[model samples]
Structure formats: C-alpha cells, structure tokens
Target chain A: MAADRVDPIHQFHINTIVPIHVGGYDLSFTNFSLFMVIAVVLSGGLLYWATAGRRVVPSRSQSVAEMTYEFSASMLKDSAGNEGMRFFPFIFTLFVFVLMANLIGMFPYFPTVTSQLIVTVALALVVFFMVMIAGFVRHGFGFFKLFVPSGIPVALLPLVVAIEIISFFTRPVSHSVRLFANMLAGHITVKVFAGFIFSLGSLGALGVAGAILPLIMVVGLTALEILIAFLQAYVFAMLACIYINDAIHPGH
Target chain B: MFVTSAYAQTAAPSAIEAHEGVAAGGGHEAFPPFNPEYFPSQLLWLAITFIAFYYFVKKVLLPRIGDTIENRRRTIAGNLEEAARMKEDADAAVAAYEQELADARARAHEIATKARDEARAKAENDRKKVEASLDGKLAESEKRIASVKASAMKDVGSIAEDTASMIVERLLGSVASKSDIAAAVKAARE
Candidate 1:
C-alpha cells in the first residue's frame, strides 16, 4: 500500500472513460481528454461570464477578465511588436489551456495535462510550423537569411549555418521538453514528499514530528509549482510570440 | 506491439494490460508519458480542445472582452474631455467677472473725477462773483466820501472870505467896495 501510494507514476495513468474507435485507430476519450474539455469550459465560461457586465468603471471580476486579456496582449506585443497581434487568438488559447491545465493539476488526484509529452510536443510543433510557414510566406526565399548572420567570417560561415539550422529545428523539442519535464518532475516530487507524511504519521509521535519536515517541503514545492504554472504558461506564449516575430521579420 | 492486445483486453484493460504492455517490451516501454499507444488519443484530444478554444476565443470570448475594455476606454476619454470643457468654461466666467469688475472701477473713477472738477468749478465761480460785487461797493463808498469832503471845503472857503471883509470894514470904519471884497475872496480861494 505504501509503495503504490508513493508511486507518483500512477497519477499520470490514462484510463479509458468513453471508448470510441474510428477506422483502425483507438481514439478513446480518456481522463486526459476529460480534463482538456474541462479546461476549455472553465476558461471559456469564466471569460464569458466575467465580462457580461461590461461596466465602464469595471468591478472586481471584470478587472480579472480585463487583466487576463491585457496580460496576454501586452506579452505578445512586447515580444513580437504590435504586428504580432495577428496570432493573438492562437497564442492566447495555448496560454489559457496550458495555464488551466497546470492549475487544475494542483488538486489531489487530478491528472496533469501538460505533463504529457505528446501534448506539449503537439503544441510546440504547431508553433514551429506556424513560424516556418509565416516566414516563407512573408519573406519567400529571403527567409534563409535567419540562418546566415550578416557579420561572419567567410571560413566559419558554413559552421555557423549548420549550428543555426540545428538549433532552429530543435526549437520544438526543447520547448516541449521544458514544460513537460517541469510538470512531470514537480508533480512527482510533491507526491513523493506527501507519501512521507502518510508513512511517518503511522509510526506514532516521533515519526509525526519528523513528517513535519516533508510536509513543509510539500507545501513549499506546491507553492513553487503554482508559480511555475504561471511562469510556464507565460514562457510558452512569450516564446511563441518571439517565434512568430521571427517569422514576421526574418532577419537577424 | 500490443495496441491490438490492449484493444482486445478492453474488458479488463486497467492494470493487467498496463503491466503486461510494460513487460512485453522487456522493460523498454518505460515511462507512461513516453508510451506510443496513448499518444494518438492525447494528440487527437489536444487538437480538438485547442482548436475549439481558438475558435471560441476568436469568435465569442475575445470580442466580448475587447468590447468591454474598449467601451471603458472610450468612456474614460469622454469623461476627461467633458471635465476639460467644464474647466474651460469656468475659467472664462471668472475672466469675464474680473473684466466687469475692472470696467466698473474705471467708470467709478471717471465719475468721481468729473464730480470733483464740477464742484471745484462751481465754488470758484461763486467766489469770483462775490469778490467783484465787494470791489464795486468799495469803489462807490469811496467816491461818496470824497464828494462830501469837497462840499465841506467849499463852505469853509466862503466863510473865511466873509470874515476877512467884515474885519477890514470894522477897522477902517468906512464903507469899502463890495466888488473889491468879492475879488479878494476869489483870489484867496485860488
């Protein structure tokens, strides 16, 4: 019982809720999918309900809604300039979805959606392809100038181009890995520390006192995870804005 | 390797298949996140939710929020403009009041100056008229006194002449010439 309780891996397990098989694919709607839908409804409904008043002066809830909109808008504009507002919808959606998922996962027994490699990978790929397509469409063949910095020694030009190409291609991998690893590792650490509380509390008074240390650590880590949830969402959207900016202006 | 196996074992697909799937790859299946079987479903759902979210934001959610914010901004701007216009009106009123005050002061000063000049002129005119009448009365009184003194001197001269003729007649005890006496008196008067 203690071993399974300490196993943080079980929390990430996918359970088939409503199994739907189409063609040869097993496109089953699992717990992860349920959480995604929840994220959608929560964010959408909150935004819709919060802004219904449309008060000129703004109430407390209205301020929250406006703050969310301004936060994403300013971040995108800051990173990619005013022209970057073109991709505001896509970038804002990603931010809200990821942020909602991270916050929801903070609850006991809630599966973290961003912890999945597939989900982050898919998000990153979308940004990557969007940047590439925008770059090609805007600058045409001149988009290759991104890899070739203007002030470079002729002899080192080939090496520089190779490094730039590799880094550019690996953007999606590092981007996805950063968020996935953070969520997975943070959840595991929290769970592992929480398991100590259960095990030590069963050992009587002295063990209860000892369990206090891990309990404090769990509390601190949970707070840190909350901060990181906002941070990761901001970072992801900001990075997307930067990539889209690169596509909009394909120079160094 | 066991995508079909998991499908077939759907009746009891919870723990046994998961462990079996892990065991089948000789521990190569490793972490649950890296498993390929769940990738399709997670990706598919992610695509659905994200796309739906994107559309909702683009169509419904964003417009509402944007309109609220825009409306607030416009209201604030309009309020500020009205306040500025009111301030301008107040300043103009104050200026007009001050200007009227200054004009009234200037008019009062002009009236006072005119009244003071008229009063001084009237006083001066009355004083000059009194002085001219006094001068005329003094001149007439002096002329009357000189005429009375001249008449008294003529009477004294006539009496003196008569007295001189009577003394001569008494001393000589003889009748003298009347014409001579008259001539003597006339010469004495001269």
Candidate 2:
C-alpha cells in the first residue's frame, strides 16, 4: 500500500547543496538554478534567431516573435495606458520567462520552477514592491491615500483602510499561489493518472478495460494542462498590468 | 477567484502536528516554516525577462502598431483623393454630355428652319411660273380671235357684193337701164 500510494507534491521538491558558509547564509544554487538557466538560454536563442535577419516582410519565425511583442504591447497599453510603455521591457520579459518555464515543464524529465511556491511568491513580491514604489514615487505622501477612498466619511476611513491594506498585502500571496497551485495540481494529476494506467494494466481483462479509462483521462488532462500553462503565463502578465495600473492611476 | 478555492481544497494537508513532539519524543524531523526566500533562479529569470521584454517593446512592438496605423491613414487619404478626382471627372463628363445635347438640339432647330424656308421659296417660285404660263396662253387666244374676226368681216362683205352684181345683171339686160341700175345701187347702199 505504501509503494502503491504516490505523493504527487513530493515530485516538485528542489534538491540543492545548502549554501557554503560564506557568512551565515546558504547561497548555493539548486536544480531550480539549472532549469532557470536553461529557460533563459532557450528564450534568448529563440528570440534572437527569430529577429536576427528581419526582412521588410517578416518570415514565419520573425512574425511569431513580432506577434509576441505586439500582444504584450497592446495588453500594456490597454491596461496601463501610455505610461505603461515605460514598463514594457519588464512586462515582456516576465511573460516570456513564465511562458518558457511553463512550456519546458511539460517535457519529460524537465523541472517546473513556477510549480514551486517560493519562486512564484518571490516573483510576485518584486511586482508588489515595484507597484508600491512607483505609486510612492509618483504621488509621494499621497501614495498612502490610496488605501482611503476620497468620498468616504471619516468614520468609515478606518474600515476601508484596513480592508485595502489587507487586500494589498494579499496580492503577492494570491498572485504567487495561483501560478504555483495550478502548475502543481496539473502536473500531479497527470502523473497520478499515468500511474493508475500502469498499475491497473498488470491485472487481467477487466484491468485492461479499466486501463482505457485512465489512458483517456491522461490524454484529456494533458491537453487541459497545456491550456492551463498558457493561461497561467497570460494571467501572470495580466496581473502585472493591473498592478502597474495602480501606479499610473492610484485613486481607484 | 474560482481557481483560488479549488486550489485551496486540493492543497489542504490532512493534519497539523504539534511542535511539542520534537522536544518530548526527539524522533521526528523538524518541520520547516514556509519560506519566501528559497529561490535565486527566479531572481535571475526576473532580471533576464525584464531586460528582454524592455528591449522588445522599445524596439519592435510599439513601432509596428504605429506603422500599421500610419499605413491605414495613408490608404484612407489616398482613397479620399481618388474619390474626389473621380467625382470631378464625372462632373466634367456630365457637363460635356449636356453641352453636346444642347448643341445637337440647336443644330436640329437650325436645320428645320432652313428646310422650312427652302420649301416656302420653292412654293413661291412654282406659283410665279404658273401665273406666267396662264398670261402667255391668254395673249395667244386674243391674237387668234382678232385674225378670225377680220376674215369673217371680209367674207360677209364679199357675199353682199356678189349678190348686188347678179341683181344688176338681171335687171339691165344688154346695155339699156342705166337709170334703173343707178336706182338699184342707191337702194342697195341705203
């Protein structure tokens, strides 16, 4: 029973050497390190190769690369307005990195960094920090006023501010958890159903018939995972846009 | 939001173990608290992604959108100019057609008027010719009548003279009766 029961979440653990005692902190790199490096190389190579010898009329590869660029540009413009153009580089990079990480994880024997809560949360925190900094930089002391609605009565100010602060703090948690949870759940489901098919196949005719159900489920779940991968990347980019919006227009 | 609840349900662990077991039993592994700082790969990626996207948007995407819009504007403007030119051409063609129609109408009127005048002149010439022929015929008839009148007068005179001669011969047989012949001549003259 112990061998038969597989822990889905255990597959996502990142094994590494604890950081060498440089000072007091462990700064050693891990499997997550290797995967991230691979992701960067893949993204860079693809983008560079696609755009290197661009003609007036684009080739298929160049058009795809350009489409990626345009898609993010339009998203930023719509969500964050013209000022969002300044953050275009950040948003585009985020989208590509997340996309690459998600796609790479779909391959056999590839680790999904986004499936880790720590990685996702850290990324979300950066966005959260940038949003706060941008708001403060633009509005100065008035940045704090974002928590309090303008038309609210003085008595209701405390209640609104508390709610706003709690919501604001939850942003990073929710953002990170969304990506991590989705990736983790999707991968686990795929692995478990795959295990079910193999485990059931060892039995006779009835087991063989039962194998078909898990096989079908595996195929269906795999297709769903691919969709979720794309969706997660899009959601990550979209949330970045929304956070940037707060910086550009704070009152709302 | 719907995804959040679903994730929460799936992620919930079965039970939470108390920490006091670690000090009392000393056999269980220490449970680590949730940490947000475990991953450095994410930071490196964040840097890479930020840099790459920054360059792409700056150099490629925005420019393409701008170009598309500019191209559309130019196309629209060109269409408008072409339409205006076509309208002018149509107006010119319509005006020329109207001018030609008017000229044809005037030409037709002129032709009808000239034909009517020519017909009137021909009729007048014909009436004059008929009147001259009638006058010539009347003059010829008058001449014939005059000659005939003269001849008839001559015949009548001759007949009378003959009759007188016969009467005289009968009355004055041989050379006697000169007074009788003279009286008969007087009677014939009276």
Candidate 3:
C-alpha cells in the first residue's frame, strides 16, 4: 500500500518504461501508453473474436459484442437519425476505448488512460475534427448556418450567434473534461479513503477500531467508482453523437 | 511493490533533491499528462491504435454481423411467401378437383337416364308390334268363326228340310217335287 505518502495524484504520474529520444524530443512509452494500447487491443480482440462465428442465433459472447454494437448504433441513430450511422464505427471505437481504459484502471497497478487530460483531449479532438469535416463536406458553406437559430429577432441575432459559436468551439474541451474529471475524481476519492484505513491503523491499538469506518468507505467508493467508469464512458459517447448530429444537420 | 516504490521515493534523499530540482525548474514535473514531453508519444499511440481499431470494426466485424442478420431475415421472409403460395395452389387444386368430380357425376346420371329411356322405348315398341300381330290373328279367327257358323246354319236348315220331307212322306205316303218340298220347308221355317 502507498498509504504512507497518501498522495492520490501520484497514481496519475507517467513513468517512462522505455525512453525514446526522437529529434530532441522525449517520446517515451510510459505506463499511460501501455494502458492505451491495452484498451485498443482488448476492444478490437473482443469484437473480432465475438463476430468470427457470425451465427444467426448469437452465442453468449456474440450477444455481448452485438449488444455493444446496437448500443452505440442506437445512440447515434437516436441523436442524429439514419444519417448518423456513418459515424457508428468511430463512436463505437471511442466508447470501447474509454470504457476499457476506465474498467482496467479499477484494478490495482493499472493506470486509467482516460483520466489523463491529454488522452481524453485527443479522443475529443478526433470527434471535433470529424464533426467539422462532416459538416463542411455535407453542407459546404452552409455549415456556418449551425450558429444561426431560426425564428430569432434580427436585432438579437448577433449576440445569439456569438454565444452559439463560443459554445460550439468549447464542445471538445467540455467533452474531454467531463470524462477526464469524473474518472480522475472517483479514483482519487477511492485512493484517499483507502489511505485512511492504513493511516488510522498505524496510530495505536485504539486507532485500529477507527479504521473500520474508512474501510467501509473504501469498499463503498470502489462500487461507486465502478459505476462512474461505466457512466462516464456512456456519457462521453452520447455527447459525441449529439455533437455529430450538429454536423449532419447543421440547421438544427 | 507499490509500498516499496512509495518508500523508495520518500525515503531516498537523492530522490527528494531531484524532485525539488525538477519542481524548481518548472511546473512540468507536477503534471505528467500536461507535460509537453509525453503528449506526442501518447497522441501517436492513440492515433495508431484508434485508426487500427476503427478499420477493424468498419471493414471486418460489422459486415459479417450484418450479413448474418440480413440472411436470417431473407430466409424467414422467403419461407413465409413460399408457404402462402403453396396454400393458394392447394386451394385451387381442391376447387378444380371438386369441379371435375361434379361433372363426372352429372355425366354418369345423364348416361344412366339415356340407357333407361332407350330400354323403355324399345320395350314399348315391341309391345305395340306384338299387339298389332295379336289383333290380326284375333280378327282372322273371328272371320273363320263367322264362316263356320254360317255353314252350320246351312247344314241345320238342310237337316230340317230332310226331317220335314220324311214326315210328309210317312204321313201322306206319296212322292213330292223337290221345289215343292223346298217351298213347304221354307213356309214351315218362316
């Protein structure tokens, strides 16, 4: 146990396992990179293995894989209609990556890649660019129409458009921060309470009895963190779909 | 292992000095993810992994699953359509069979009636011919009887004449003329 230091932020540290210097830049493969790779591989391997059989009546694992597909697909369809199916693969990839990363972080010794701002920002930027490109490609110059609301008084149009544009640009930032903050906070809270159990035990014979409360808190926090992991992943994917809807139907 | 790492970081005087030195130089040591040093690497790996996974899902897995679902739907729809067509064909066949059976029954009845009528007409014609032949025979017999009766009456008349002549001969004891005898007989008969 890292109960002595009791610094929850230490878990987010990126230690380079293999340092690589490229053109005077430190591009090392750290613990963060390893988990990111694990997330990708696990998600890809699961889908491939489940769909390899392709039985009409799905097997247990196949249903799991199909359920994931249907979940992301329906989420996109519901937010953006039939046209949203074009981005199903991208949104699904984003979902599984974040989900697997969060889930693996719940275990000991595994770091949460989604907890890192850089990683979440990277994923959000992908959705951001996809929305922009899709918007421009489909609607051309009319993509700028996304900022303009219909039935607004002409006098207030400028202010409303400015607010809409500001909000639009902030999409990626808020999208990334939501997932990153949730996972980071939940893990830190659990770690802090876990440290409490050990710190109380070390005080004295009488302090051992006091450790029971933090111990129960740690147990409860673990369950809540697990739920947060799943919820954040779902929320991240759902918001991405909603943002993409703006691109597909710019007027809306 | 985690306890040892924590102890090593905190207990080692050199590690503390290094941390202070790095912290004094810049705030980069405080946040590793925000540090410019690791962003390129994280971004690089993320791109590679995400693109690979995206293609795997888009090109490979999705098509296979879609194919299975589509095939199942097509099979079910085709089966239902074929069953309906078969039902319709069966219904038509049943109707045709019933029609043929009724026609055959009607033809059989017509043939039976025609045969019975022919037999009755032939019997009627035979009876009429036999009646005609019987009538001719009866008429011929009746004519023969009439002739015989007439001849018997003539014989009876001759017998009476002879009886009358004998009576006259025995009573008068004289021979009479044939014409006179005949005339006396006619007067007595009258």
Highest-scoring model, lDDT: 1
Candidate 1 structure quality by residue, lDDT tens digits, B1-190: 2243333433334554456546533132235676666778898999999999999999998888899888888998999999999999999999999999999999999999999999999999999999889888988888887888788887777677677778887999876677787787888778
The regions of model 1 sitting more than 4 angstroms off are: A1-3, B1-30, B152-190
Binned by DockQ into CAPRI classes (incorrect, acceptable, medium, high), candidate 3 is acceptable
lDDT of 3 by residue, B1-190 (tens): 1222322323333443446535533222434444554677778777877888888878887776667667768888999999999999999999999999999999999999999999999999999999999999999999999989999878877887788778888999986767788888788768
Best by TM-score: 1
lDDT of 2 by residue, B44-142 (tens): 544554455556545764465446545556777999999999999999999999999999999999999999999999998899899889889888888
Report residue B177 deviation for candidate 1 (angstroms).
10
For residues A147-237, what per-residue lDDT tens digits would candidate 1 score against the true structure? Answer: 9988899999999999999999999999999999999889988988998998898899999999999999999999999999899988888
Q: How close is candidate 3 to the true structure, as a TM-score?
A: 0.71
Task: Give the lowest summed-lDDT range of ten residues in model 3 chain A.
Answer: A1-10
Deviation in angstroms for B130 in model 3? 20
Residue pairs clashing in model 2 are A19-A27, A19-A28, A89-B53, A89-B54, A93-B49
Best candidate, DockQ: 1
Which segments of candidate 2 are over 4 A away from where they belong?
A: A1-71, A202-206, B1-38, B60-190
Query: Chain B TM-score in candidate 2, rounded to 2 decimals?
Result: 0.54
Model 2 agreement with the true structure over A201-232: per-residue lDDT tens digits:
87877898999999999899989998999899
